[model samples]
Target: MSMTPIVLDARTLKALAHPLRVQVVGTLRRFGPSTATQLAERLGVSSAAVSYHVRQLAAAGLVVDVPERGNARERWWKAAHDVTVADTRTLDEDDPDALDAYLRSIATAITLRIQQVLGARSAMPPEWRSVTDLSDFRARLTPAQTEELTERLHAVAEEYVRQHPESEAGPDAEMVSFDLQVLPDLDVGDRS
Candidate 1:
């Protein structure tokens, strides 16, 4: 499978702006192919609502229909790509509103995933629990330094996973979420 990230354009940015659609695509990517009804049950949403959003995702080419996996009763769907990128330079200049919504939706979805893991942390195996992280650090750096930091972090993160996808994972392995955000806050400690 291709590892290229889907750079959001006007059409795709608008298509994935909704929170439900964002969650749908995320679910497909994380859990693999699934039917609308199955996704609805997993997400605690109505089947009709999930179906509607899935159709929209398919229309925007963010998802694809798995005809071979489907029978007469239900249709299967999977994410078209493993990643979706919102290039701040292009999107911030072009469609800021849609860009804001799409990014916020993603942030909300990520927060939910964090919460899910937190809730299940106590029941996790000792090995997994030992490696769990929910921490942050602060630093002062120039824009160029920040860019270099991000590139280096991505390189380190991609090292182990590049050759071993979830499909090729060993029996003792489990799918994990590894998120990286290098946001620059110009207005730190300014509430107003």
Candidate 2:
């Protein structure tokens, strides 16, 4: 499967503002095609709830039905793309409120994932725990340089995924989440 990133627009960003929708899309991206019942079980929600959220995601063009994997009674859903790139720079400058809301939604989702990882850290194997990282680095660069750095980092990540396709990996290989955030420090004066 080709894992291309989907660039989200204003409308899709608004649609993904909901927490459940974010989780539904993330689940599909990580687990491949799954039915509402399977998603419900994994997410600890009801099948009906998953089905409803799946429909909302489909309407937003974030996910689609995998008819080839489903029967008459059940519908399988999969993410339309592997990665979601939300470029706040593309948002309308007049609609600062929308941009703020979208950023908040993204922050909430990231916080949730961080909490989940921290909560499960003790359960992870010794090797995995040793490799897990949480760090902060500050850098000064021009806008163009920032863009170039982000592009290079994304390309390296994509190359890694292409080389280590999960489908071809061994059973012992675990799913590792890599979250990257690069932003200018708003409180530059406060930095020590």
RMSD per candidate (Å) reads: 2.5, 2.8
Best by lDDT: 1
Clash numbers, per candidate: 0, 0
Q: How do the residues 49-144 of candidate 1 rate in per-residue lDDT, one tens digit apiece?
A: 999999999999999999999999999999999888778789989999989998898888889889999999999999999999977777878889
Candidate 2: 10-residue stretch with minimal lDDT: 90-99
Reference-based lDDT, each prediction: 0.89, 0.83
Q: Which prediction has the highest TM-score against the true structure?
A: 1
What lDDT, from 0 to 1, does candidate 2 have? 0.83
> Tens-digit lDDT track for model 2 on 1-192?
476788878778777877777888888887789999999998788999989889988998889989889999999999998888877777756355666776776677778888988999999999989999999887888889999998998888878888898879898898877877888989888544
- TM-score of every prediction relative to native: 0.90, 0.81
The residue-level lDDT of candidate 1 at 102 comes to: 88
